[model samples]
Target: MRHGPATRRGRPAVSGRIVLRLDRMMVERGRSLGWLARQVGITDANLSKIKNNHVSAIRFSTLAAICEALDCQPGDVLVYEADDGDDGTGPRP
Candidate 1:
C-alpha cells in the first residue's frame, strides 16, 4: 500500500509546525485552566493537553470556544512556525 512521506523514525513528516500559545494567552487573560475549561465547556485535562501542545489536532468547535472564552483571536492562540528545512519543496524525508 502507498503511504505518506515519513521521517527516519517512521513518523509522518510535516512541513510546518503549529505552536500553541494557549498557556501564554491564559496567563495574559489571568484565567486558570479549570476556569477556562468550564468556560470552554471542556474538561480541564483536555484543555491542559492543548495548552501543553500535547494534542495533535483540535476541533474547530473547541477552538472557537477557546477563542470565545479567552476573548482573543485564533492567531493569538496558535502560531505557525515553518520548518527550516522545508523551502516550499515538499515533505521532509
Candidate 2:
C-alpha cells in the first residue's frame, strides 16, 4: 500500500493556504505600521513580515494582540484558501 505525503510527525500533509490581510485591516483602521507594531508589542520589521505574508507561522498570542489592536476577529485577518491548483502568489481580488 502506498501512503500519502507525511509531515515530520508522520501525519498526512494538510493542504490549503492561509492568506494574511494585515495590510487591509491596517488601512481600514487607519493605523500606521509603526503604531500597530507598538500596540501589538512587536517590532516594526516583524509586523511588516506578517503584513506582507512573508512568515510561515504566527503565534496565538501575537494573533490575539493584533486582533485586539485592530478591533477585529481572527477570521478578519487570516483567510484560508482551498487548494484549487492555482498558485497563491497572485494578488487577491
Residue-by-residue lDDT tens digits, candidate 1, 1-93:
438889998888877988788998999999999999999998999999999999999999999999999899998888876777333335556
TM-score, candidate number 1: 0.74
Error (Å) of candidate 1 at residue 90 is 23
The parts of candidate 1 lying over 4 Å away from their true place are 1-13, 85-93
In model 2, which range of ten residues has the least summed lDDT?
81-90
| lDDT of prediction 2 | 0.91
lDDT of each: 0.88, 0.91
Candidate 2: which stretches are off by over 4 Å? 1-4, 85-93
The C-alpha RMSD in Å for every predicted model, in order, reads: 6.3, 4.6
